[model samples]
Target: MEDSNGSGRGPTVQDVAARAGVSISAVSRAFTPGASISKKTKERVFDAANALGYTPNLVARSLATHRSGIVGLVMGDIRNPYYPEVVDALSRRLATHGFRTMLTTVWGDITVDDVAPSLVQSRVDGAIIASIADADRLGELLYKNGAAVMLFNRSAATSDKLSSVRCENVEGGRSVANYLLDKGFSRLAYIAGVEHIYTTQEREAGFVGRLMERGVQLFAREHGDYTYKGGFDAALRLATADTRPEAIFCANDITAIGAIDGVRAAGLRVPEDISIVGFDDIELASWPPYGLTTVRQDKAALIESCVDVLVEQIRSGQRTRHIQLVPVSIVERTSVR
Candidate 1:
């Protein structure tokens, strides 16, 4: 039997249905998950499908179900070691649930606006926006187009259209502050990530707020822009200043690692001259060279929660907003005195 295309390519669903002595809808239902079809008919359809070497076309199935079975993972900086871990775990989890991940990187010349249309066109059932500086527009576009959108590791203040799963950034910051203060470091400095991002603002607020509560003030603040070079430069400047801080808290692990090198370049010893702490305990944080005292965001818990929320939204065809905050804890190491 010829395919619908009449190219004699191979056996199609139509041929399978004919060979099984069933309607096309019966064959389709037999292959669909949780679809209601009688056991005898399903067995017949499967036997015919096997004999004809008929494989269901995902594209055609998507057209009929209006679900692409694709989840778009939008990110800005894939270079960060932290994000790669997230991607790996997230992709694996999504696969177990019978979904595929489509990675879309928006950075440098490629803005969110440029990619939003293509993602929508791809008919993605859901999206997880991970670590984008400006995700409001993209989130709005996807939400309006009937796709479930969840912000991973970030939040939007003004937009109520998106769901999010992130760590308790404020609490994490407070923990770091208390840890440093308990170490008897009076003069404390902060190395911030991107200034406009919500994570940066919340973390700084928690850290500084706790410091104020303890009758102390932030000694200095520097912008690291969440980059290695940015962190290094900021640390160098802070270290060379006339009145240097006794301890510095970086926003993330990459920044903290860079700050370590920066302190050494300024001829200072870690925890001996200036105690350093970081957030997000990435794999590199535990290394011997940079045993960073940092706040550990539970990556596994975060991904599990994120996937659960997004999949529920996709399956239910509901865009109910949810914001989940995974708890964070401090990991003590040699970096802090």
Candidate 2:
């Protein structure tokens, strides 16, 4: 047997075959999904591959089978508690189905055109993008390029011209608005997250629409970059207004937490002087400090559905081009009456 590059060159498939005393085709069959290889040979190949650090080349497999077992997760910042939970749920679910997750945070710096090349290089079998409807063309190109694509939380135009998984943003907005009104908050303000994102826009529209139904109006509105500090600074502005709002609604939990700081530092009591509400009942929302009354997006179900749809697309080579809207609910807590 010829030893090639003991000086830092990693073991290859050939090395694994030689170590296991098997033909090259037998080693390939052992690793390749659905390929016919005897159990004993499979075990031997696996043992050799493990010993030699000979991980299967996913790209090479894609070239042969035309199916990559990798999924690309294109999303925004993972700093938000909601996304990390979604990612964790999706990653585990995908793993159970023999798919791996590759994460990418656009961070609003790169364009849609820049996304596909990286995903293509990684040879992701599918992609799940959490973004607004502005990237319809980009999404279309991805689907056209052979990767299954799904949009989470945010809606995107599909190959079928409908959204995939459209959450009840409007309903959530009404729920928050009614909760505040029921608690008798007359003066109101909204701390929005990342002006262009779909969630913020939807929640704002829904909340404002419902508030108008009660003949109430938003006294002020400020932008937060879906961040804690963004909410903190925006909260200060709202609280210090000439006729400050008696109630403030943030788009997400992080902003709500920051708003809490903003409200307290201004010498106002929570639920007494100023009531607050938020969306996405993240883990932090239930903490003793926040106890935030917010909308629940059913993170587990959403992630499961996302993975389910993508896996089916990959397996069948067909699009499950359907928009699934999971329901949202309002959870009452100390922040609201």
Model 1 lDDT per residue over 1-337, tens place: 6654467798888889999999999999887644678989999999999887888898889998988889999987777788889998999998866688999998778888789889999999999997775797888888988999999988876698899999999999998889889878889999999787788888999999999999999999999988888889999999999999999999899999999999999999997999899999999999999899999999999999999889889988888889989999999999988
Model 1: residues with Cα > 4 Å off, grouped in runs: 1-8, 14-55
lDDT of 2 by residue, 105-223 (tens): 77656666667678777767788888533456656767777788888887763356423675688889888888778877777888998887888889999999988888988878888
RMSD of each: 3.6, 3.7
Q: Which stretches of candidate 2 lie over 4 Å from their true place?
A: 1-54, 132-134, 157-163
TM-scores across all candidates?
Answer: 0.88, 0.84
Give the 10-residue window scoring lowest on summed lDDT in candidate 1.
1-10
lDDT of 1: 0.89
Best by lDDT: 1
